[model samples]
Target chain A: MFDNPERTNLEQLGEFGLIDHITKAVELKEPSTVKGIGDDAAVLDFSGKKMLVSTDLLLEGIHFDLRYVPLKHLGYKAVQVNLSDIYAMNGIASQITFSIGLSSKFPLEAVEEIYAGALLACQKYGVDLVGGDTSASVQGLVISVTSIGHADGEAVVYRSGAQVGDLICVSGDLGGAYVGLQLLEREKRIFLENPNIQPDLEGKDYIVERQLKPEARKDVVELLARLGIKPTAMIDISDGLASEILHICRASGKGCKLYEDKIPIDPMTYETAREFGIDPTVCALNGGEDYELLFTIRQADYEQVKGQPDISVIGHVTDADGGYELISKSGNVHPITAQGWNAFTSR
Target chain B: MFDNPERTNLEQLGEFGLIDHITKAVELKEPSTVKGIGDDAAVLDFSGKKMLVSTDLLLEGIHFDLRYVPLKHLGYKAVQVNLSDIYAMNGIASQITFSIGLSSKFPLEAVEEIYAGALLACQKYGVDLVGGDTSASVQGLVISVTSIGHADGEAVVYRSGAQVGDLICVSGDLGGAYVGLQLLEREKRIFLENPNIQPDLEGKDYIVERQLKPEARKDVVELLARLGIKPTAMIDISDGLASEILHICRASGKGCKLYEDKIPIDPMTYETAREFGIDPTVCALNGGEDYELLFTIRQADYEQVKGQPDISVIGHVTDADGGYELISKSGNVHPITAQGWNAFTSR
Candidate 1:
């Protein structure tokens, strides 16, 4: 509890005072904490495990639409996505620091709800909520999460390791989240246009759920560890399979050849895409927010994952001379293009 | 260079496409990087040293005046402040992850400048610019930095370790940054009134720089180490001294007695405070952003720091019943109050 003797002001005390005031109460619990408050960063000892680190931000209106987007899910998703980054690095998150910028619209309950979600996520993931910051925004809510993780030194995979001829694979199907978003937007339009319309969402449960309550592929990471196969390269299917593959291609100094027939799309996702008059494969290719694992493995290790139910091999890496191309079932080869979200993008 | 053959729209490609496009060109240099780009976070080898971790966020109007504040300093300070936190933890930084919410007002160069500042700080701190996320913000620029560092097992300090009668010490001086801020605001007002009058900033270099570029007290940690002394507890002076002390009192479950005369104020800072019609002591006590180190040391280690020029021993810890008190120059004791910046106090 704070003692408000004279009703002190933050501006009068300034930013430094606010930071010191808030942080001064934190205490170190372990000897591994060599330094805590005066240096460039906090230092720690994690025995011999590899270090993991990642950061992500949630912007109002862009990443989330506050109307139906609960504050709890927002907080949970902020931490989860950052932790997902650590998982993408093949690491187990141990600590996280979260930062938030909220407008006057936020009440005490709103902030607490956000923390509730974050705390719930921490408990679910077995990670500690280490530290964070909160501030007032001019107009919207913004949350940024940074997670620290630990992994075995030998078990980590990276996007740059996709050698020529490495088998490109993905965990589960994609495009469900995108289709789900489409369904939500459609419902949003109907609700906004006329309040009398009973939302026709009874049949689109899977797609809508995928859009609203997306889960990080934490299960896949544990499953991979248990299955005893480390991918040569890996990335999360956040934007789409095509875009993520290009990331691997450029990073590994190689090219990718993806099979349209092999691209996995959920039945619900396929149906929703057709209903929206979009190709299900295209939705899987370029749709965002899948949060699935896309990875490359050496051909020799295909035997390790041959009949796994959750995994599918969609393509193979090749030398750069072959170019970044997508092979369609009808023998059509199309060059991939860049079309991910860009802030500077005028459109 | 990107081959911008077909100018695909970002909204069409969506968030996933953007992530892939942005990450496509990254080639990680460290072999210690076990996995990257796909998981919850990036994984790096521990490499035998203790680690450090810190996170900080910079909001647009609250943290900086964009009219004069350059993007590079914003980026640099964002990283620097977090690094400073690690330093406060008595650790050496190794890795950092950044997440940014950029407004449409900024062009690519603005982002580059911010990163340039971040890069400079990384080079200075010997840390890797490992991973980050950049996304659109409807409001203003938001930069959040999460830094990791390593600390020796023996030298770590926490706020909860203060004992009854440990000497309170602070590195460097305070109030200069606050005074400097007053000057900046005053000048800003003048400039807004009429763009003709130049800023009357003669002989005001120290305070202005203090506001513009406050360095973290990294040297104090090294000096203390060299003096063969370990602080019982430590925190950086991001907030004011009163708030920081209150934090120590709450965390350590103890009270403290501070001497008004013992508080450190640089001569320039003192003069500036007076010029602004502020009590220099109050300014020093309540002003924030000094980025100095506030710590406590045992009585036995008194001789080790007694002769240090930059350090000041201001008070001592006491039992909970003693209560937090400050002895004035007139030999009058006043019970300490926990009053500092409150973001909601004004709103």
Candidate 2:
């Protein structure tokens, strides 16, 4: 009964097009709303502190594979994924609402166990379980989480503040989650082919845990405040370091140089990559879902957090004319590509 | 690699158990958060105003049937449901975040059409479109919308605020959406058996629209403000009138009385119910997807809003001992039972 040409094929305009088109019509008239749409979380004024709101949805067979994934980790990961957005803005998550599409095959207790894991994460993260809806689904389960956080208005960070010569830092390790997925898929196929056989899962604990229960770098956000250091720009590393670097570069109108050797890859991840016959550096650069924090800090403020063992200065913001490049240990420089997690490829 | 207690039948807990179990381990320590999980929305202090965060998820084949429903109304209804929860709190909706999961079957055109409907609702409701995430799905479309609204600390209404002898008022007519659903289902069966048959939806325009494009009651909220009246208790009728009445009564620890003849049903809805051989009154009380506001006001303020055509004073809230009952035109008292919508019944 309704057909409007003004709004057409989303693919024709692409995902970014869909977002840009929808956002153009929005009018953020509220005086308290400092920022909307562009940041990791929508910023809201709440007395002395600011409120940050962010939402995300994960679907079965698309965002996850049930064959190699447990429901508990899925639930925990859903909350963490949403929380990462709030932390990206230097905000502390305070409340979360989880909306789930429940398939009929899932019984009451099974679903509760999933929520048990989610509520556990809420407790760990110090966010309240607010409000959500549970509806029947025809296929696998779908979970959507919205997290709201609080921050000092002046402390809120955006993705467009990287200046030339600023240092790019990443928290903890990278490429472990992607490598972990490969290991799980490999074992899953072997087990599926012969039900009687017990597959081996040794020496790959770190990578597997990274895939299963990856914690968003909330600690880094707190540590930054503790050390009295501020990031000029910040974004989480979910869509691989390569894509995230491009997001910062494009948004900041600056180029970047990532030192290959400086990228932190755990020993388990490197060893696992060798076993799988894949390059660890490429896996870290292109494989996604690390949940690490990729941010930029002023050169002068770097000294405050430089001694921290967990955070690593992997690269530096360069002039736009410099172009995005990665320098390897052997001194070869290659252009960094924005090949991250592509949901459309599976379809 | 994933297998456990979910293989067989497991249904020990009911809906209440599910909710309690889901919320068991959550902790809310934020000072700005006034209420969480137990109420309709997460209440927070937005400076002097009380802010609310509520979320809802709508799935294909469960909440809607894609066979007959258009993508535009589906998108519009998704946003409206979340806005309804905000309106339930007696607050002005400020912003919304939309998360969607689409299957490969849908071309990009369909996704854009859905957003067009979402953007249209945002424009009509004066709410800002903030942030959301989208992913791929294997089967059907799933949409989750989170809405944030704010009201003065003193003016925010909750379900527990109702008192004895208060007047129960409903904004706009009911039962049309329910009757419209029946018509759509009946036509879908016929169309499924033979695609050549056309849906006879010409004469049932109002009922069809009611089912297809339900609007949130921001107007009633505005009118109440203009008339200098605050509702003692409020809820949105997304799960039929009888179910909502039971909720209000349960929360307020009181009972209510309704005049059967006074219940508002559009003429077209009545005709459709008659055509479908269903009780029109029962449909008015139990039909859902109306997205109308249900509130109770003090008896003295009845004159304040009685002149408005859209605002219907259905009945009065009675004492705790009164029990929930309906007084028919024949002077017979009948106990009202809650027959809320349950999506568990697949057919």
Candidate 3:
């Protein structure tokens, strides 16, 4: 989208040349990275630490819309989403492999912007870009990212470790990303209908940024460790709070009672949902791509997290016989069903 | 192209339902894998071994033609290509992450076939399917595989360690995969031209299989260890022998003399190339996707591999001043240039 006349065609450079160009600016800073980009595989040494591996795939029309998403933000968000999985496991991501496929319509500069954003995220998160595959696609752009991280065996968290009486907690706010997406989609529709109009996103920067550039909750994991509280279980909220909590309950063979009022919704998100005739609580429960951390800790450790500004106690784990329920602000108990966003169905 | 009329629509299963259905039969047999699937990330323990990570992406139309490629074979070959990268580094692949994107046209049965083939490869290679991401694409199918392997720090081989005077060796034969592709394209063209005509593919099974179901050289890596011979340098022959050897020379800052007469071409591959009015030697030099191992060894160990039927010593490393050269069968020397298959250029 830049107004640059000089554009290099990818056909002239070929695949290997493109790989060399993309990797030329990469600097490996991870101590565990023995080798990065140039060999058949990148060599890494975890040095007796447990390894965590996660992958994410983003497609053209399914996972994103290029009309509203910048290539740089797309690249940055791709890396962040994969790293979020590692953070969900209470691990520090160290290296990542990013593979992308694009049609000839993409110029060399566009590809550079994607890598620039990806590298920026890596630099900020202190991860090394190790190895990846690049190819020409038949249609739209496709991106796949795999992140590798490490943690001590005992320090690693699992979603199946929540026990009865564990306090259910969440970090940051929920529903902002989903609300931000709604705002962008509306603006896109308006712009499409009237080419002379500009998107009015001035006052919605906070919610819009949440959708465009959500960060993995690495700081939350760090905070929990700093407080000397190992979460009994943890998961990143990629598919809404209700769906993720249900995942924990299924995996841990436990039930949870979530308080609708305690589910943190940013004022912007709440107001936006209300303006759109959507219930704010429903937005918090069913919206996706928040990238916040949902975790559980023992009752004794609740005191350590109670005063944390970013952390909010939303619920508590219970016996499986209790069934999953949400207590509304009106003191009405409703059965929780997973109406999580499904990309396939949504498409 | 399945015979069953019953088809389960992907939209009906949703994303998580599809994931659960696909991974229902995955059995984890790797001791290094602590968690497989059903989590935000897979946990692995490499103990004291160094890890090797590699990734590959295969897009429809560019990488394969659905008219000739079976879904099962596509899945199998995709994993094999990625694992081959790990083997090229002289490491044993222990885990793999398989991500895929497809349109709504695909049924659950079709997706199941893809996974069946992938899991079959994992079973055969003793590798575990640790984690992956699945999504819906706007167009064609997309497959991305990442392989994780391990080796002792001192035991890993790189493409940059070849020294002058070391002999260049290649495992198995070259040019078969390329020739096989040519045969399949011919058959496809003929079938497209005449609806009633049955294309002739008889007695071409060897080359055809080489193209459709090539296996990674894991056995060759094991054989080398068993023979007590550590390669000075090694790389897989993915982009033809000439291009791969040039990679070694460039990485090592050395030149090489590749003898055309010493290059091994399967008899079927030679006949197929001649049948297509192509030079067999050129096929061996410039053909891609053979998945054979190319390596260098100390001259002292030449006697040990001299009688090996599968290994061929085709050249020797030389000083950079000597330049990259190919000695013809007529004893005339020609400077070697890389004409390796470039997917982007070819498209």
| Candidate with the greatest lDDT versus the true structure | 3
Candidate 2 iRMSD, 1 decimal: 12.3
Q: For each candidate, C-alpha RMSD in Å? A: 5.5, 12.7, 1.1
Q: What DockQ does each candidate score versus the true complex, computed on alpha carbons?
A: 0.43, 0.17, 0.86
Task: Write candidate 3's Cα lDDT for B1-347 as tens digits.
Answer: 44457888889999999999999989999999999998899999999899999999899998889899989999999999999999999999999999999887888988998899899999999999999999988889999999999999998999999999999999999999999999999989989999687868799999999999999999999999988899999999988998999999999999999999999999999999999999988888898899999999999999889989999999999999999999999999999888976767744
RMSD, candidate 3, Å: 1.1
TM-score list, all predictions: 0.89, 0.87, 0.99
TM-score of 3: 0.99
Q: Which candidate model has the greater lDDT, 2 or 3? A: 3
TM-score of 2: 0.87
lDDT minimum window of 10 residues, candidate 2 chain A: A1-10
Q: Tell me which residue pairs clash in candidate 2.
A: none
- Candidate 2 per-residue lDDT, tens place, A128-226, comes to 665566666777888889888777767877777899999999999899999999999888999999978776777678889899998988899999999
TM-scores for chain A, candidates in order? 0.86, 0.86, 0.98
Instruction: List the global CA lDDT of all models.
Output: 0.76, 0.78, 0.93
* Per-candidate total of colliding backbone pairs: 59, 0, 0
Q: What is the lDDT of residue B214 in candidate 2?
A: 88
Candidate 2 structure quality by residue, lDDT tens digits, B251-318: 89999999989888899888889988998988988888898999999999988888889988878888
